[model samples]
Target: MSLAQPAPTPSRWLRAALPAMFILLGVIYATWASRLPAIRDLRVLDAATLGTILLGGGLGAVLSFPLAAWLLAHYGARRAALYAGLGLLFGLPLLGVLPNWWLLFAGVFVLGAASSCFDVAINAIGAEQEREAGRSIMSMLHAWFCVGTFSGALVGSAAAGLGLSPLWHFLLVAFVLLLMLICAYRILPCDAPDPDAGKKHFALPHGALIWLGLIAFLGAISEGSLTDWISLYLTDHLHASEAGAPLGYAAFAGAMLVARLVGDRLKDRFGARRLVAGSSLLAAVGLGVAIAAPSFGVAVIGFVLTGLGVAAVFPCLFSAAGREGPTALAGVATLGYSGSLMGPPLMGYAIHGYGYVFGMALLAVVSVFVAVAAMRARLLV
Candidate 1:
């Protein structure tokens, strides 16, 4: 049905279901993120302490990757997704109800593992669908994820404003997400592995997958930095009210939402090679703008630009990894995702030591690597 894809074929059910899974995953993540300020205030943690806690998440993700790949190999993407999705749901409530920071850290760590494993499952399914769909569908799929985040963020802000507890908010989100998962399960591939699929095993990154993984790593650092920091930055630096703190984050996700909606077309027009290079520089400029901005309002523009700039990178990189091979995809995804999960803690340490301005500027400095990688990465795919 698509103009550019080469494929033996993929199921219509899979093509239809994977995008919803992407959205559901985003909702799961954003809901927790939306309520972060509440948790911060409740826990009374400083930047350094919070960074330490967030590091648990990165560790969890690292632990989960091999397990996730094994699950995918033995049970297939569908079962892996459901298993991790449930794990994530179980942890969301713990984040709100934890008695202290140490327990919270443990809970977050578990959630982080669930998050990455879920991501791997859906992305593997997405890659399969993209190959079947021909042209570029990855961006559009991720766009749904953005949309879910945007909705969750807005809901979180409203919930905070309405005097709802984080515990209650998380429960409500979990219920909705659970329902979505129930629907998704009916349409996804069964637990049995596909013998003909040729990707039953996992391997370390090799050849082009290495370059693609590097590209994924670089871009993810920028993305993770923004997603984890923007809301807090709006509050601490700009003195925005708690209810309004999420606006900046919303702007960031909204820009990504719009960009990815259009990303497939852009990819078609420009190709991943040239497009990613320009996008990296654009993100750098955007970060610079946010860092130099005189007001919260102006900084939001920068966030929007930053979001728009990096929106296409994941879709392109992941799609290319899929093209390389399934084992390569798993390897590249783990490393690339490692970069994203690590960004928050790294930036947390930065902001703790220096200041918010310096922390943001650090992101700009990091983008330089992304720009260089983007240019060089074209040939690898």
Candidate 2:
């Protein structure tokens, strides 16, 4: 490694800080999401009004991703992450204090924008650092994200169960996250401008890059659909106990977490494309069982299979995106994130019209398509 070769092998500080950033982002976003019902009740808003308010975040995410690409190209991933991290720090407290409709709208929008910026920047950093290190660490980094989500959601869920104030709960979580961000900023490696960054600011992903994006889209929507619909399907369609309905999703998430933690080794053995295509089929089969069996035991098994199946997908796809160029990766990630955000509602509408079984079946169909696509694509990895 030369003196100018991007800090050979990634410093220990960077390895630690990158995952910490992921944890912080996950905790912040999950904590906020878990408290939405409380926020709705406090504001005395109907479902429609609340839905509109939540849409602010989605709108903000879509609008800012292109800007995130520009920032990554011009300022580099580290600075991009730092700037976006500030958005998270400031936005967390604002979410707690919004008292009026307009303020609520603005608050969510800001928080959404901040989260999206951080999402883009941090993933860019993860991909950058992984390339510099010459191996597969994206899954490990993403596992920390899952860990943070679980930790934060558990804490928030416990707090809510205890009837804690949402405002106070949010503020405390924000304070802790703020501290984490400061430490990460202090120790992580700095960034330099991309010499290759020319007059071009953004490039819509084409060729193999578009295939990667499509795969990301499918994987994300499948994951999102499972999270949103699992509980409802379990209780409504499968007749699981109220307390037990959540176990289906718990199974799914837990399996995915475990798979991601071990995914790097599996990728080393099987290769990413094989892992992706094979897992997509596994996920499809699991979802097929959920559609066919319609029993509690089978449902749990299905969820587990689905989770394990797609666990390595996002990290794998993102790794391929990195090879395609940062701008192209940005486009790919934006599309994937958008699918995650939109997939739940779309699945919900389908469930409403036909049935929960129909929705799961739809995802099963999509998973098969992803498998076919994954088989065809020429991935960089």
Candidate 3:
């Protein structure tokens, strides 16, 4: 099980296909966020109610992780991934068409559950692939997610510009995702988890894993806060034009994508602990710079810095989770995902009560906590 062992290299097509699937997932998921206004108008739900309903998706995702692990163990990673992708194809289009808040909520919940299951299974498979390849590949895998988000945002903007309905936009994207999933089906591994892995049950997170979960939670909070509110912050606090406001998030995402693309080399040279620690500190500095800047241009620089700082943390955390034990990796990943789930709503509440600048400042403080925790965990490779 040592990662040092020489293993067969994956084909170029497989490497390319894997990231493409992740990108497709990101594009499909992000389409909903970009069209939030349309969905709200269609469903006639207020902000508060909408937030509450969105929590159902998080709940469903959390609940599904254990089952996902069991399925991966029994049915194998390929089947689990295929089922999850099919679920996305089935569930994503409903968001565009659902006319009622209740139906939209239910659809989102199922989508979340299926997506979470897919996430764990795919990560496990990807980690295995990386181990076999004898190189660090996780960061690039996540980079594709950022790439997908970027693509989705661009598509959303195009649709908005054209005055296209959300349903039509999503339908097109869903068809594309369906086709991509079909194409990637063959390269996905059918390997099952080891049989003697023991009884699987949902249990509360404990030990170093709990600490790792907290680190992930704090890191996610920083990331989620920026992604969810950076645009609003630019508009409300910096007085940037609506068109310019999204630049904050765009800069962040672009920087993150760049960092992730090169992160494996960085990790190989510096180790995960150093990288995580440096990233947290850089993120904190970025937040501070953005908050204190006098102009939107400077704030954009800050956003880019924050993105660079945050880019590699997720892959490092996921790799650590996998190394903790194959049997426990799903539960750990679930905990991490749970942290990510909490970040958006909490940041929303913070923004509502304290204003966007203060909320981001709070996130900067949390980023410091992530640095300290990463140092304490000492889980770097």
Candidate 4:
């Protein structure tokens, strides 16, 4: 009789868990960056100039994405992620303390590049893990990002209350993220890219991926605008107290996290096409209400609706990309992230040119296009 071959060992659930940790950590770092407006004010930079500097981070990420994809293919997800995380860990604390505007720009650029690399590498690992586990888990994975963002807000509020310097606050976050990377190292997958996956040099997105990229871009613009500017909007337009301004973002993020935690179940039960279409319409209505409402309470409710509507869209897009092919996944994620890079600056320019209300109204119109694309693409399911 032939000896029985050992069954393949089931990978630990911790592999899935670690990526969430990184998402959370990255979000915390972003919250730290949001606190930088105050730092910029202290340093005497005008809004337009600060906006220009902010664009540098996006440029760096755009430049880095193709290179990052190649590195992930060659070096494996874990190693690439480790290097990226280390870069972010070092880059975060330096942003506030760098003294010179150019130095600060350089720091933000490195931060953007490193974070983009980490994002793609982690998503690649998550995709592989999803295959191995034989289940849909992408939505829950992203829910953790919302949770992380919420947690980061809390941390930022506390730090602000205590009057901690930006340098010290970011330094603390960096240290924690460093420890997280060390702990997460073992659980991540070590699978190398298929030797025959072909040498497809990184190029600009086109075709269906371009449409997908546009969807991502619109979604990112909406989300980034809310995250980057909502606090100021509430404080200035709605007469919200400084402490209360963050609550607007908290509402947005909290609703998003709750919706995303349940998103996979919703997708499985309701199907992707239905979920995306309905959510998009709901988001459009939410934005409309947000813009039209005279009361802050209504505006907050609108923000919550907006969050719920958007919660599942990005994860659905990511899942769609994964289904496309492993080789294409990096390009897809990069293109999607390019939206993140583009959204904020675009909003900034719009606000500078057309006032905050018009800028937000434009986003509302953009959400309608997202709904239309979801219906037309028919790829959601």
Best by lDDT: 1
Write the residue-wise lDDT of candidate 3 on 84-109 in tens digits: 88897878877888777777768878
TM-score per candidate, chains pooled: 0.93, 0.83, 0.87, 0.90
CA RMSD (A), model 2: 4.6
List model 4 lDDT by residue over 287-311, tens digit each: 8888887977888899899989888
C-alpha positional error of residue 302 in candidate 1 after TM-score superposition, expressed in Å: 0.6
Question: Candidate 1: TM-score?
Answer: 0.93
lDDT of 4: 0.72
Which ten-residue region of model 3 has the weakest summed lDDT?
1-10
Q: Per-residue lDDT of 1-381 in model 1, one digit per residue for the tens? A: 331222333566556677778888788767877777788998898888777787778889878888888888777888888889989888898899997878888998998899989998888888887888787888999999998888888988899999899999999989888888866766665545646354456666766567788888878888876777888888888888888988788888999999999988988898887778778778889988888889989999999999888898898888888787557777887777777778888888999999899998888877778778777775433
Q: Write the per-residue lDDT of candidate 2 for residues 1-381, one digit (tens) a residue.
A: 332223433567656888999899768756675565566558876544554565566667778888888888788887777788888877877777788767887787787677777888888888888889899998998888777766765676667667777788888898888888877866667687666666665666687788887887778778755654576577668886534555566567677778889999988998888998999999999888888874899888988898889788888888888766778778887777666655665675676678777888889998988888887778735
Q: Rank the candidates by TM-score, best first.
A: 1, 4, 3, 2
* Candidate 2 error regions (>4 Å): 1-12, 36-55, 93-108, 196-198, 227-251, 288-301
Q: Rate residue 46 of model 1 by lDDT.
A: 87
Arranged by lDDT, best first: 1, 2, 3, 4
Instruction: Spell out the clash pairs found in candidate 1.
Output: 5-134
Off by over 4 Å in 1: 1-16, 191-200, 378-381
